[model samples]
Target: MYKKILVAFDGSPYSQKALTAGIELARCCGSELHVLTVVSLPEYAGTVGEVEEMVGKAQDFYRKKLEKASQQAKTRGVELKIHLLFGHIGETIIRFAQEQECDLIIAGTRGWSPLQRLLMGSVSTYIVRHAPCAVLIEKGKEEDGNG
Candidate 1:
């Protein structure tokens, strides 16, 4: 029933799985696929020039990520749209999905332990809690390539 679907992806292998799954879903539902990547401000020393350099690299990274995902979706015969945003990862995802009127959001989970999750705050968890639409979290494949 989905008509527009948004997927949150980073360059991680886990996020790659989410892109794949989102593509399949979009194909099945004849939905428009929107792939979102957040170019976060790196947490470190930030001189003006250094900040500019980091932002440039982040832009390039997201550019490659969106291109890769778009190519994959093209091979599957689904129309794909790319979105890039800058801010806290979770907030950016939530805002974009709302603005685009996505029917569902598909995101990848990195499988952090309870203590670690508590320390680092999970993006998937945050999106699921805050998104106005339904959300699906996909865990990346195992070493054997099984689900």
Candidate 2:
């Protein structure tokens, strides 16, 4: 059974799936649930003020999403702890999982093609390869409600 479960969420449909799965798993195992959303700053911001502005904007945007997710978990009788950090997606997720001592990491995938992943570098893939704990990846179901 998992003691702590971390869901890497970004408010996308794919991440929504991950959140749902994480909630279910936490409920089943009586685990602590955490949702982490990371904001990756632009490589070269013109000024430090710009970087702070970007983080502020991202916080404003993700706060609502995380709140909604918290409500969702509440309906399932699970308490959700949320974290927002600034860093590369995969690296940040891994580091947070380690720091939080998560027993499981759940993430959703966009189902990128091999070629697309090669070029774009999939975050879920990177996490799967490098995460400190066990990882679960959720993929979207087909239109027929099958996966």
Candidate 3:
């Protein structure tokens, strides 16, 4: 049984599936549920003000997503705590999981092809390699004709 569970979300359909899975698992285990969305800071900014503006906009965007996620969990009778942070996505998620002492971390995959993942570098792969605890990656459904 998990005492604390964290779901790494990004407002995507894949992440929504992860949220649903987290909610159901939390309900079953009577665990504290947490949803985290990380906003990747720009690699280069013209000024500090520009960075601040980007962060602000990201916060606003993720806030609405988190709210919807909260509502979804509420309907499932699970209370989900939401968090938003700015950093490299994979590192931020792992750090937050460690800080929260989460027993389990759930994340969603984009179902990218091996070539795509190799070229793009996968966030889920990094988390799986570096996370402090157990990880469950929810695989996204492939679109028809892709195969």
Q: lDDT per residue, candidate 3, 1-147, as tens digits?
A: 999999999988778888889999999999999999999987887799988998999988989989999998999899999999999999999999998899899988898999999999998899899999999998876342121
Name the better of 1 and 3 by lDDT.
Answer: 3
The whole-model lDDT of each prediction reads 0.86, 0.91, 0.90
For candidate 3, the 10 contiguous residues with the lowest summed lDDT are: 138-147
Instruction: List the candidates ranked by TM-score, beginning with the highest.
Output: 3, 2, 1
For candidate 3, give the lDDT of residue 50.
84
Candidate 2 per-residue lDDT over residues 1-147, each given as its tens digit: 999999999988888889999999999999999999998998878899989999999999999999999999999999999999998999999999999899899988888788998999988999999999999999763331121
Return the TM-score for each candidate structure. Answer: 0.90, 0.93, 0.93
lDDT of model number 1 = 0.86
lDDT of 1 by residue, 89-128 (tens): 9999999988889989999888778898899999999998
Model 3 deviation from the true structure expressed as Cα RMSD, one decimal place: 2.9
Residue 60 accuracy (lDDT) in model 2: 96
